[model samples]
Target: MRVLRKRMDKPAHLGGVLRDALKASSLDVDLDLYRLWEQWTDLVGPVIAQNARPAAIKGKLLLVNVSSAPWMQQLQYLKSEMMEKLNSALEREAVKDIRFKIGPIE
Candidate 1:
């Protein structure tokens, strides 16, 4: 006697599968961080945004580039507040800390 076997269906689009994989591996957080960089101006005020640029995200720490040493120093002082604002805006603890560096903003 022969037995019948059931077959699994495949996703219509690869996009969904890839997105699911990314979420499963927690890579979606990195994408969210990229989005945060794009919306930096809106998240922080124009003044601070103009002087600073979100360079990268490593784990829970965010690296920011400031146009001048003064701005970098200022940002160092405001790091905690910035983290609070960013995490609150994201509705998650995406950013636990921020590091400010004196570099080219653009």
Candidate 2:
């Protein structure tokens, strides 16, 4: 007669496992971008959120679409502040700079 034994492994939290997978797959930045889009209003506040929206992220630069030229101009003055807020929320320096373009948000 022979006996067989099975090995058991500890389970990891789903969020942490997904985050690790993203980091390993080099899609961590994409997750960060998704977070930015998902939490834009809470991250930046309703006013900025209403006038500006994240369009894309290239390297450390963040491209934003503003509702109007005046809003774009206004956002220009708040670039550094916004970067600080974004990076703080992301828990990393994923967004280093911002460029605003006049465009429809949708």
Top-scoring candidate (TM-score): 2
Using all chains and alpha carbons, the TM-scores for the candidates as numbered come to: 0.73, 0.75
Candidate 1 per-residue C-alpha lDDT over 12-82 given as tens digits, one digit per residue, 9 for 90 to 100: 57898897898677577778677888788888899998999988888788888899988988888888888
lDDT of 2 at 42: 91
- Alpha-carbon deviation at 4 in model 1, angstroms: 20
Q: Supply the TM-score for candidate 1.
A: 0.73
Model 2 superposed RMSD (Cα): 6.4
Clashing pairs in 2: none
lDDT of 2: 0.87
| Predicted candidate 2 versus true structure: per-residue lDDT over 1-106, tens digit per residue | 8898776497779999887888776487677778899989998899989988998887788889999999998999888888898999998898878999987785
